[model samples]
Target: MNPLNLPFDSDAMLEGLRPWIECESPTWDAGAVSRMMALAARDLADAGAEVETIPGTGGFGDSLRASFPHPDRGRPGILVSGHMDTVHPVGTLEKLPFRVEDRLAYGPGIMDMKGGNYVMLEAMRQILRAGLQTPLPVTFLFTPDEEVGTPATRGLIEDAARGQRAVLVPEPASADGGAVIGRYAIARFELLTEGRPSHAGWALKDGRSAIAAMARKILEIEAMTTEDCTFSVGVIHAGQWVNCVSSECRAEVLSMAKTQADLDRGVAAMEALQGEADGVAFTVTRGVTRPVWEPGPGTMQLYDLAKGLAADIGFQLGCGSAGGGSDGNFTGAMGVPTLDSIGVRGKGLHTLTEHIEIDSLAERARLAAGLLMNIR
Candidate 1:
């Protein structure tokens, strides 16, 4: 069933991936993420690819662009996109160390992305060892801020994707080992509430609580969720001292919609919430956003190619849309064919229990190698 006949050992692959998992490259820690990017850059350069490290801006980590040499190196070719940053903060390894239990491999950022990114690298290494060149040149773009909607690297991702033949994202595969052909629109908002602070015991009636006002607004925003759109306030901060009425409170809000129109309406509703609440001043500031990407003919065709490759590797690859947008959203929205979530299959992304099915490493690497060798 193996079309490429490339030798792959799951155990060896996991061993190679262990270092990546151990390196905690959280999005907010620029130095930590840069170290991770440096590791990747070394591997890419050693693999005979021309690597370029693009420094990060806005307090983010550096990005990498690696291009493989081909007769048509300058022509349109395949672009592989992935993120080096993760949601897990540093020191997570102390509690969630990289370990293998039965068929699952556990670690911070393993299943969500490091596992998939490693698999792609292995695929490329195998292809090179086999002394074969792909039909088209391959380029790898690893960014450092995808976990936070790529606040600093969106332009780099889009610029690299433009004029490319196709884009492939190695985000964790779907629950059923499927690939993503479309993604929903996503919007982020920052909410702030400021109120008059007073001594809790001395001026209980006169004091206005910012936390209370923020809590009410959070409930109101979450209640706006519908089948077509969803909303959640994930982060909140308020009240430095317990004895005093809170003077300021802030929260981060996230909204996802199946369509751009629905997201527009949601944004309008969120922005309209900026007003006075019982002497508390409330404001909503819009943040980064990902546009909706619906499957087009080119995307379907790319998926079809991947499906055939998966079948040759002894699996049926299904295609569907997904939430939690990836870099594919940018390329897909730009009318370039994109296939996402073609990485290792696993569960519990962004949690302490995050892990990947150990067996999916070799299996998915074969699929990735096939795509690299056959895609024209």
Candidate 2:
């Protein structure tokens, strides 16, 4: 069935998008994020979902788990994944308030995902109005910490995904407007260097520059990048005083690999790294990890299912992997049939210019609803 053939009023979807954009829910702001969850919970309940608010860890706000049962009362269900938090902080809307111009809707979190989150809401709304019964049960998880690596909600996501038939993530579409079929294993690490400090003019010979040591390590890490494996030093901090050889330096390394062998290869190499200079020593600390989500047979089969649904709506759907991690990584790694980026096609996801194509709303809603109803 073509969900686009169903009634989808673009203006009405915007009426829903306006208030959600106005409610800024950054990852760290518990109050703001909880408020956003409350608003979404109300609508989910109105759409006939059984909603539950799970408390977050360490005061990071709460996550919403909403469920809709099939008419036949199925046991296992399909999981719809999303997040309320965004990279933008509070009051960003004051500078870039929600506005639609030239068929583009611009706002904080609009594409990076509140746009995707709204797709789930609007899809459920359409399904409820039509009174269509799903063949399998459905679960929608609105996590609070996806932008920050899903740290707080990682276990929650995995637990909810357990025994589910398939997992679908409504993350933003690819730059080329494709669905996410695979995801790279996200390996984050921090490099810390300690060395001797000395006066630049008089005791320069006594100094062992930590910055110099880190620069060498930086080259070493960057050289590990291959056509299939990617690595980058995203953040670096070194000497503060211009006249002194700094004693400390630090850097954040982000690496991605498509296969487990490559992920292990990169991780082992970093863990074995030591300072090249005698007086300059280094420490490598492993940070958060989202295991690489290589599309399995199950996942590929799910993509074929969604591809057919996209064609039903009059569009060709392509699939690819991303370097960034999502809650889908946890579920996908758990052996569930996972498909991601089934949301609005847009540009500038994490930038100030983030916006979605105004027309993607209707089509993506059609696709999402079709998946929900047709995922038997």
Candidate 3:
């Protein structure tokens, strides 16, 4: 029952990768993402899989959920996960078309994940062709907007994963080329302040400056962070000019908490800023983009299963955790055993230098197929 018997065309996989890279499908650009999903869905459905396009939360690309029943497997399933949205913004394609030189292919989202999506697609195709009976069923979720925050699609991912045996995320390979097993929780906050404006020279003493108050709050927020619980004042917008005391100022914070207690403490510190300034009004919006994922009961078992499967296929596997976040964090947080960075090994991700290892495609595809074969 070698899963490598599954039908796979390296040429087809390469074909899929080219268009994905040539198109600039950023998280917010729903149109391009939709087209990509449709193509993937059409191909997947033709291969005896049920497919559904989950509409996004009023954005450019929604999510695509597809399931392939094993020849004789029953209920419990394994989900292969990835995101469609990339960090590339609009017009990036023209700036950086897909290029190949010296065994490297560079483009917008190739390694970050487009190539991983291809790996999944080709692996599934090969499995179906082989007519193998897997021990468990397989589900694939391609979410949009993962590059940004997965605010619009978190619930969908959780719902698909409920009662599943485990979930696998194909984020890019680690810098050390090892697979990732854990990730940090992400919290983003917006700080807005409002104050009455007055002439800088004539009535400066009477008006409270929103920008000054905002600056002080930013400093306090920074001081609240630690080595494990990190924080950054990411974006700030405020004030008009020097002629008048500014009436409004806004700042955004991106915080990463290492543990549940750290998250609670960070949130409390963020909320505490609301009443710090007397005359200036303040508001805060908080979002936990992804939850922290560490080795636990469900996850450790899942890792052992995946590692065992990889060993059977002759691929030595290693695992590590990361400070960044992903949808894997969401399911892993919900108590599902989760493993990430199962995609093709690659060097650069989310940059113009992004590329997937051409040689790893076949091996990783076989690895994915084998993992799916042992899902239950």
Query: How does each model score on TM-score?
Result: 0.98, 0.90, 0.87
1 or 3, greater by lDDT: 1
Question: Candidate 1 residues 1-376, lDDT tens each?
Answer: 2335799889999998998899999999999999999998988888788999999999999999999878899789999999989999999999899988989999999987988888988888888877878889899999999999988999999999999889989999998889999999999999999999999988877889999999999999999999889999999998888889998999999899999999999999999999996899999999999999999998998999999988878899998999888889999999999999999999988999999999999999998988888777
Clashes of each: 0, 0, 4
Q: Could you tell which candidate, 1 or 2, scores higher by lDDT?
A: 1
- Model 2, 84-193: lDDT tens per residue? 99888998988778999998999999998988889888898888788777778888999898876777788888988898888989999888778887888888898999
When sorted by lDDT, best at the front, the candidate numbers are 1, 2, 3
| lDDT for each residue of candidate 3 in 47-113, tens digit (9 for 90 to 100) | 7789989877756587888888765444667888898788888787777778777766778888888
The prediction achieving the highest TM-score against the true structure is: 1
Looking at model 2, report the run of 10 residues with the lowest lDDT sum. Answer: 68-77
Which RMSD does model 1 reach against the true structure?
1.2
Judged by TM-score relative to the true structure, which candidate is superior, 1 or 3? Answer: 1
